[model samples]
Target: MANDTNEFWGKQAEPFRAFFDMQGEAMREMFGQMTPQGLSGAIPSATMAPGDMAEWAKVAGELQRMWLEFVQERAQKDMAGANPMDPAQWMLMTQSLAKQVPMAPLESAQKMAGDAMQMWQSVFTRFMAGGDPEDKPDLPRKDRRFADPAWQDHPAFALLHQTYLMLAEYFTKAARDVEGIAPDKRKQLEFATTMLVEAMSPDNFLLTNPVVMKRTIETKGQNLVRGMQHLINDLRRGQLTHTDSDAFTLGENLAATPGKVVHETPLYQLVQYSPSTEEVYETPLVIFPPWINRFYILDLTPKKSFIKWAVDQGITVFVVSWKSADASMKDVVWDDYIRSQIEAIDHVRDRLNVPSVHTIGYCVAGTTLAATLAVLARRDEADKVKSATFFTAQVDFEKSGELKTFIDDGQLEMIGKLSSEGYLDGRYLAATFNALRGKDLIWNYVVNNYLLGEDYPAFDLLHWNGDVTNLPAKWHRDYLRDLYRDNKLVVPDALSADGTPIDLTRIETPAYIQAGKEDHIAPAASVWRATRHFKGPVTFLLAGSGHIAGVVNPPAANKYQYWTGDSSAASLKEYVEGADEHPGSWWPHWLDWLESHGAKKVPAKGKRKPGGKGDKVIEDAPGRYVKTR
Candidate 1:
């Protein structure tokens, strides 16, 4: 028994010892190469001599051969024990083998070659017939893919465009047909392939991109140098530095809404905007913005501010600005969030002398709000909430858009390992979100900031998107497990905070729910499912634009229209069929509904200064919590 124990422990220790020994050797080699004399000596002096292109080429070839050998050896070792024929091990073995095989890419290349032949033949025929080759394209073009006219007019560019499209299609089909692979893994593979294809687009390369080439020549390659500098800085920082952070000041330019920090906890700060109207509603409206991003999305600018709009409309608005979690707040769970939000609400109630306050929540905050309401209902404290409003929020995440592809048993377990360390870094969230719309978010930036070498314009929405906040490990894990992975939000008593099991059906608070028609985060159909869970009178609205634009839309803009209907329909399909289309922003309709439900116009009381029992005013609106990161 002693020998067996020793053998087991020795086996474990041996790996660590070997690893450290290898690491030490690697460190020594790295340091030796880093020395100025050693670095200079490593490069062949003959290759460095003027006009010695042949020597340089030989060196490059040798380096390439060495790299290939190393990769081949590593791959062989990795695949040594895998058996592709075994039924039980087939999926794993195939996945490993797939990494070594470029079958799909080869097929795509073949197809592109054939297509190129046909295009050249067509061009030759047009030229021989005394017809202009630039008159029209032989192949039909996709509006969204390669819309640039230069791509069609130039033979080289046309060939490149067609090749890319064909290759992208082939890769996509191959990704989907990755046989017997787990759904999450398959999705990840597909996403990765999509990103690669997008990155390889001719428009991203300075040589292939006429627009960028023109700009480079016009600017004397200064733009290219600047872009290289930006890339180096970002790599050094280990984060994609989006936006010129120096462009916008927090309080002055971005979240500049006039308000006071009436109360605060370690988790959040409650901002009560000073009323601009002579009279305010009897019931105060408290909003809980999603903690995934800063709260300033609601108060972006004076003209586009939702908080200011609400305040101006005779509503006393209070917003919960969540604190950015760090390592110290890793233990903060769902219960902590619920408790803190309730405490904030209690403070608002006491300060405003209002019995029941109207509650509003957006996205993740809305989900949390619903959970908190259910918990409160279980405790017989549901009367504190007069009415509830959800913006682009979903309690039922069955079909929660493309983002759902990242949620699975394997992925969640991996995420759990990372979460165990501390807070889930915000960069991961940003990257995932960016991946969802690669063309618009990721590839667009790659072209503009990295390729075109232009500074991103100081757009408030983009700034808000870039300013990410960390999520507590425990809280985020629970959220994913309950709401996302297991679909617990719709399951009665399946989700709970503290000791109480939350049942959404038990909460009879009249609710107003809005979902964006084009919301990729939370699909309107998924959000509409929440209507069935609520026992109270529910009003559902489907807005025209995407997640952020739908909610932040003001009436004056009249940009996107909306559809409104009572939640009497049996399904989302039925509701949409019967819903009435409104020509402008849904804010006026919401205000009217709110006023009818419980909000009453009254003579405005004296402005309440920022302070509360135990927790006094720490700072003005857009408080310290919002500025943590």
Candidate 2:
């Protein structure tokens, strides 16, 4: 192994020895001026000031300048066969650098500097001395951004790519090495820096990205012209274009689940879907999706729609399509939504003439549903809902994930100010969620649509994602304050809904809590905490993907895996270790669980009118409320 390592470095070191010597000399030169008294002098032993984001920009700019100068200046003179830079070639190094942690001890700084020097040597050697490129890419399997042939083959682009990745990684570590700050704040710093670094990746820019450059050359800059037009159109449309919006219509293609609006309120439209099976479960299923986005996500396409699948599997489905809240709705609170939920359940029960309905909530709606159930329990109406299922929902915010970054006092104050119109703008939530996975949701599109000028595809999911919705200001504030920030929802009676004190522990409703292993919005750990509150039979399942795709995974696709039978464990980690792994979607597992929990099959209703005569059809499914925006 040592011989192999030596052999590899020996080959690389031979051609760029002088280049390495000069670059190492350059680092030492900078280190003399930038050194901490010994390292903390230049780098503080404490965390950087929370407000001093400008400092990150400065440090990043300095590194960018030094690297560009070092490579452009001495490489041609020092390294054999090293390509000499032209004015056009120098333009390739274009992106501005971002911030990093401002502190480190002298020894650690020096050691990092040495490590960086070695990485610099290796990349330079590979770019300049290493002539022939390999047939396959050296990039991580997941990051396809640099898979283009020119990125690996061209010396200048290769230099930029390798250097950017190395620096991004180094700074990622440095961002986490902060001292004297709360773990949360440090994590915020690290997340901010990571996002900044990713945002400024070479591939994100047209000049630095080989694929975009190739497209430009091929199209004679027509791609840029078209992309600019797309930018202007999107800007005019008041949102980023994530999909070909014209490709799918609400009732025509997307959200095409057959159903009719049986009930309507100021808050929501209750769409009771037409049953697909001859005999369906006697107890109907009522879904309350998060108003943070539209409810169509549960019915994206027949291939992926969980609602459609459930209906086909002999379950009558009723979904609540929440109105896009505006000034009038801004005065509403969490209690109001709970009341509305109760009203919807009553209507479904009266129309179906059933005792109770199987209730389900996704994301924030699930969080609130837990509160509603508790309220029902407190009121001695526990039998109102036969079963409760939460999809990637966090009832207890104690173990909340990245979304908490937006809930601090300072940020909440800003949000309140922005919500002067009585409701928080949907765009704010859109931006917030986008930030959680900005590399994919935001930057990737920036590179593809704006830089590479690729036309956005017709994707049902992205369309739903882009279809943002507003939250009432007071309700939003109360939620952030009570549930997320204070974490009162899971603490017995710390919170209330519609004047009823919520005590989750008092609720004995059978629960099926499904969490995604990769869920960022509602992490598995946070979701798992709900199991402790359910006095009834609790079945916790962990799905394979993130919040959306994980839950939306269909059986026919046979994509991803799921885990079951580890609810006995105390934590998500322990549960995962002991859980039974199932191949494919968790849908089937959930189906069995629902039936076992008493989703009895009987003659299907709605041969003439959907939900029978009692439930009058107001309009078709994917009704007016969903089409409002």
Candidate 3:
């Protein structure tokens, strides 16, 4: 707090060599804490020589001098609560440097004149001696954008792709090298630049991309004509099509696990799944999935359905199907969502005649569940929830990854404007998330459906991803302001749900927190930090893949693995070192931890079922609410 300026610029800036050492350590920490080593694949493949570092430092200093005004202007906006800087500007500035100047030099003074000339000569001599520009140079790891065989085999295509990468590298390096700015702001600038660079890739266009062009040539332009049709269809729907929508029937194939919607509310519908075993756990399991989207991610299919799996394991499972907010739900605040959870908890207790139930909260729902637990504890009803499990839920926002880019002053204001009609449209939230992974979620579809004119196959995950939902403006506003931006959720009683002060430390329920090793939305670092907030015995698990793939992982697939670590490790590094890697889904491990929480089994023959209670059955599993949008 004391040093607004890590100020690695100006006269007081740390010595250039020392500053880079500090930067290196910070970069290591960021990636080391957020993901496993193999996942940090975006780093430049080529390493810098000692002399190159000095030249790079000089270039950086020159860049800082040029961009200092822009940073200052942004700082002013930040202080005034203005939108500050737009990402497009970041892209334009970097693009200009790469185009306007060949990144020539800082040759005004005699400083590095000999070195600069030698550098230029070396570059020219090296290229002239090289056999072919078509021969691929060392490039960034994990960049599958140029994976097509033609990109590697065809001379012209290879040259074109390599040139694009050079320009991209130049622009990104320039944008990321800006100094005289705070670290958080630097990250936003760097990320925005990278996004634009990724967007402008040669592969995204029909003409420049070899594969798309090849297909168009072979199809005699019919590919482009079909692509136009897809464009028209997407325009009508107001978004890109990620899957063959017709292939998935919600209640039939997608959310197909048999169950009954026993309880319904304006905000959510509680679906109590029929048990698959003769005996079930006395304590039921309740899932509060993210309202920002549908709950069916956990109940996708018989093979991948977590709900069905639990049911088969002699555990009765109930999941909340949240209502997509409309104009009528405009006045709903954060507490209303909290009350809905409390209501669902009580309803489950009353219907099943159980003292407590195990609960699982995925993504945003998990954050609110923590607050719900605090509310329950403060209200002297903490016994209602037997145990808690969080799937990629971030309570501490300090290391909340790229999602924060959308929380800037201007973006938040834009959200406010969009939500004037009570809540922000589902499309807006969906678009924001799509932009985060624009290369895949946005542009990949753009090239496939609009350029290559390919029809997307039926994919359950993409189908689920496309079914976006509304975000309550008031609740969402408070969420962005108080939680994401303000960092108040970690403080004791700093937040409240309808006047009941919520505190995380007050809740004593045992917790099993699962985080994706590669989760970007709810970063591993951010998720791991929450373990310290709970006073109970918290068991933290790290799963392979990302937020969606990791949580939806099915053991039978025998795919990616997971890791178990000590919750109280001193740091993320220590925590990871202490981790014991396991070769399967974390679902079985979670079930074991849940059962050990003292939930007794009772005969399913005479179980006090949800439908027979006063609440009664509303409809079938994955009820009418999920199908609303």
Candidate 4:
């Protein structure tokens, strides 16, 4: 090689290069010492190894032949191009081939080693820190975290745990691999290598890297500091403007103007309905939103929120705004939720003077709706619910996606153990759900806001995620035992909300079920299985994204792809009828159906304009509850 100054490598690379050269010298010295000491024949039976050596030689020859062939093929490609022998061009070819090699396995191996060392250390640390798993406190009473059916059988979590175990094993094996290495050379080669490997490990680097962890602490401190700054900003702005009935009107447009609130209804003003307004539609719409999130996601912003779309399409909507559970709501159960929904429906009935209503149940709310539907059907009150729409809802448990991994006999029993307390805590459920998406959701937060000192806005979506609600223990236990463990929702004679056999066939209302193609909670196939149980006209729509994104999806963006089967043309089986085509977002198709069912404009009953006598309005569009946690 021509003598050249090390211009390509910076001063930082020198220490690494020097260390590498030292390792080679150490290896040579180690071999020299062993050769004369007669310890070099340490490998199993050198004399008997001749036959094995011959086989190895044969394998080496074949590998060389294959490698030569590969080089020749590449050489031909290079020769075909102009300026074939240019050294720089050849370097590019070499680099391209080098890039194709899979380095993740090597990276993973190092990670395994580091994780093993940490786990070994943790045994001692846990003892000192009093963090032993056995010392963990018993499940709390009134903890809603235990009640979520997803807890019993979450698949993503199971995968993460399995990955963790494999990493541990890999680490232990690496330590063994280096054990046979000589001690004198160990410092030169193995020690530094171990340190470097440990430094880059997922556990060490991600879980507890001093540099990264310090940055995280700094970022969190900065966030609090910034929060204080925002409070100051608010105070300064408050001086310029005035507070109008607990609502602060911004003097400066510091936040993005018209920052859209998605997947919820506007509740800026207290909702008011006059009983004197005569009904135009034959049936009204009563939407049930999950207590886990704010009710308004369905009516988020003007054009995008499902509630807005439905209202614009001329459907009379009444959404229940759930109050955060306190000691007063401690005794609530599945029956209570059912009663609340019924009471809301009654309110709509009294307001519009309508006979029956169309009930749309979303996420976990759908399960509650199914129970109510069954109760209504048994009492021959089917006239109460004109039709039902389930958005990303699961009635069948067999193929319920990753959420199932958290459920099993053991987990359910554990939940039952926890429920002796009054309510299921929502904060715990939020933490676990956040854990499920640790790499993307949790780690992303750590790196972005914590490590990078970035500021995320007080967006409505984030706010809703922050605002969590508790679940009653009795309700949650039955939910898990019936829905997840036993797959009771679809079975006619399966255990019911009240222990009476739930027969979904009796819930014969026209049903429209929608699920996302990428939904991790409830798969499309699981939603499609509703056809087998419900005798009603079942319409299955497969949307494009995940649970939340798919439902909040709008037409103006026009990003998603979805499919829907004929509601009455035939059963879900016969409707496909060899059709192998894909359709776009279910939003427009749903809008069309809603328009067909929607009543044309009846005269504005009360007044042409607001008398300001009705419940106060928040803003023209997006509401207050969504903006404020």
Q: Candidate 3: misplaced stretches above 4 Å? A: 1-143, 606-615
Global CA lDDT computed for model 1: 0.72
* Model 1 lDDT tens row, 1-629: 12422242233233224423443453343222323343234335554555443443443444344445544764776633322112233233223323322222223445556765775676555434545655643553353546766666666666556655655665566666655556655665566556555655667655566676677546544565567556545543435656886788888988898778877778888888877777888888889999888988999988889988998888889999999889899788888988877887788889878788999989999998998899889999989999999999989888776776666555566556556557887766776687678788876776788667898687888888878888998788778877887888888998778899989999798999999999999989889888889888898999999899999999889889999776788888888888899888999989988998775677665544334345356678888999998
Local accuracy of candidate 3 as per-residue lDDT tens digits, 222-306: 5655675676566445567899989889888889988889888899998988777878888898999999999999878679988
Q: Which candidate number has the best TM-score?
A: 2
Candidates ranked by TM-score: 2, 1, 3, 4
Clash totals for all candidate models: 0, 8, 1, 33
Model 4 Cα lDDT, one tens digit per residue, 289-398: 87666665665444456665554444555565555444445566676777666666665565556677788888888877877788777778777777788887777877
Q: Model 1 misses residue 144 by how many Å?
A: 4.9
Instruction: State the lDDT at 609 in candidate 3.
Output: 53
Which 10 residues in a row give candidate 2 its minimum summed lDDT? 89-98
Model 3 pairs whose backbones collide: 83-410
- Candidate 2 or 1, higher lDDT: 2
How would you encode candidate 2's per-residue C-alpha lDDT over 1-629 as one tens digit per residue?
12422342333233334534544443343233322232223333256564433444344344444445544654564532211112121121111111122343222545556766776566566655544566333432224667777876776776666666665665666556656656666666566656656666767665466787688656644565566556545544446679988898998888998989989999999998888778888888999999788999999978888888998898989999999988889689988889989999999898878899999999999988888888899899989999999999988888898877666665677677768889887876776677678788777887788666788899999889888887899999988988898988877777777788888888799999999999988988899999887777788999999999899999999899999866868887888888888889999888888898785678875531384666557899989999876
Clashing residue pairs found in predicted model 1: none
